[model samples]
Target: MSSGPRDDDVLRWYVGVPIGTNPLILMDFATVLVLVWAFAITAVVLLQLFFGHSLTGEHIQAAARLATRLVLLAAAGFAIISFLLLRNRYTALYRLDREGLYCENMRMGWGEGGLGELSKSFHWRPFAVPPLRDPAKSVTKKVPWRLVDKVLPLEGTRTLLFKSGRGTAARVYCPDDGTFERALRFARAHIPEDARSGPEKELQQS
Candidate 1:
């Protein structure tokens, strides 16, 4: 029986994830403030323009003002539901080693585009619907390494994606943060000496 390390076995560890940051928690406040401020500023400017003209058309002015406020509110509301909350479910970490690629989904998030796939509903209504389902973007579904080749990390989110090396491909997405970090540390610890980089190389030199 082969006793040493096989060319395709990987070691993984589960590291704990830090609590969600305060800034992340406070994003709701930030969004509300920005929206309120933007609307207020626009209202002030429009008021100045309308009044300066000495045209006392209250009905027209009220309609235009209501339209502006409704538009702004809709934009801000969609931003919160679609991005702030849903996108958080899309982060993950990826580790590549000689024993094949290892992908761990351990991040927090919900909707697509953030770390998930933009949904069919979101296709026509980008701002109205959360990213729901897409076969190509489903790269974080945990699977054995023998099936993956390329892995893409979502920008600004913790989601990591995996795919067939080339040609026809399958995809996976990982959104778990704590477990993925731990697995990455473990993979780094066991990666072959020849394939190690950064501090890994330095450690071997010592």
Candidate 2:
């Protein structure tokens, strides 16, 4: 049986994901904002150039102004909804030693001022029609080495899955090469033999 990290030498890994990593999120905010604002500005300018010299077009001018405001408002509303739907990923911290394993999910949030701190203040639209669960984010967890039932290495996804005897589990997604190898190594060294899921064994061979 292989032993885990020493008490005096715990192994640690950290992962931070940026909002711009996914192009879908970027497109959601960027495309809508650009298209809506551009259309509204263009419409207003065209109306002024075409009818500004007219003396009896007060009603037409008022209607154009109102339409521009409505378009801008609709665009802003959609952008806000997209922001709430596509919340950012949380930071992940993993610690493993001879005794146990610990995984923490740190969310990014506005600090007291504008420092952008991490906190539990991650409040999205709870009643969203599509229900945004933010699968990339994880909740905090701690488990003893013995209580761990299995460790599965997801290759294509570059993630590690830790299942516990108490039915609790944690999934760590690797954003880069460093985190993926470190997590796989930690799971192999610490997890018990009987708890090796099929994929985990393949990871060991490779």
Candidate 3:
């Protein structure tokens, strides 16, 4: 791991998952399913409202069937997206600085050089179904330290999860024990004392 640009002494590292087996990938797939189901249900309700149809057991069953179909479609879409990402050996660079944590999926393999630049120039129109963008071109999430309500360390996966009241704000995937230790130490220093949890808090108490 190395510090980022001259502007800030940022701790940064790259995490590459060639197979898309990371738990975060599954979490994203689940999120897609949830959103698809939500949309399907909302559409059904809106259609019923437009026709002045009251809610009934039959309508509920029909909604369930529709949701199942939508979930299947979402799963297919997820598979295609995962394939595209894994085919390129998905790589993400994580940077932790004074302000917050920044995670950017970098363009790898085929999507590099001039082609990647060309893709970056293209913009999606509002309300239009956008094509599957390069994994590197995906939106990045920046989680501020102030919103970190809990720091959860998973020894099995060598991952440190920064969580807020809402949910996981950021996930730092350490490549090794040394990296994990360094990240945990940095988290302990920045995160509030009251938010500390697990064995770290116990050790601190002692």
Candidate 4:
């Protein structure tokens, strides 16, 4: 095989998928905390409106202190949310040429060509999506996502990674333009008929 893709290779289609732990899990917990905070603040405000007249100055001061705490708590919730979602970035790369395809599961931390140990590789004829953990059997040259971030949206891209190969291969979902489907078909047709198949079951997202 050639050392690298050529300039006029006519990159028919390419895409990468990024993977990350679900933010929904963190979101659910954050919701609970927010609900508790809202309920507590509401209760305090109600009590103050009804009981402020009879309450001593000290009691009103205590209520004010409680409100302060709620503000701080709200700020903390925002921070937690940013931490959970912002920090999480799932990334993958899938690029195809007339000859073969190049896909990488970057969310596992393959940024740039730094996939050194984390990258997976596949070629056209006798096409294959080899696993990274099983390195001895596979000899793939890492393929970087030269334009994954530029062309595709992140969420859609992230969902793309976990299709079939966990990190190496992916299921071609309802593509709006069939880029993924074409890539999958191209891989199957061009890659070895018996190229190592991916795991039996994989993460499925509609």
* 146: Cα error in model 2, Å: 1.8
TM-score of 1: 0.26
Q: For each candidate, how many residue pairs have backbone atoms clashing (under 3 Å)?
A: 28, 0, 0, 12
Best by TM-score: 3
The positional error of residue 106 in candidate 2, measured at the CA in angstroms, is: 1.5
RMSD values, in order shown: 13.5, 14.4, 8.9, 14.8
| Per-model lDDT | 0.41, 0.55, 0.62, 0.37
Q: Give the TM-score of candidate 2.
A: 0.45
Model 1, 102-204: lDDT tens per residue?
A: 4443433333343344332122100112223232233343344455433443433343334344432322222344433433343444544444446645644
- Name the lDDT of candidate 2: 0.55
Q: In model 3, which runs have C-alpha deviations exceeding 4 angstroms?
A: 1-10, 18-20, 31-35, 38-61, 85-89, 97-99, 111-141, 194-200
lDDT of 3 by residue, 13-76 (tens): 6554333345655677788788888888878977876796687777767887999898998777
Which one wins by lDDT: 2 or 3?
A: 3
Off by over 4 Å in 2: 1-9, 17-82, 111-139, 165-168, 197-206
Best to worst by lDDT, what's the order? 3, 2, 1, 4
TM-score of each: 0.26, 0.45, 0.65, 0.26
**Candidate 1 segments whose C-alpha is farther than 4 A from its true place:** 1-29, 32-36, 39-43, 46-72, 75-174, 183-206
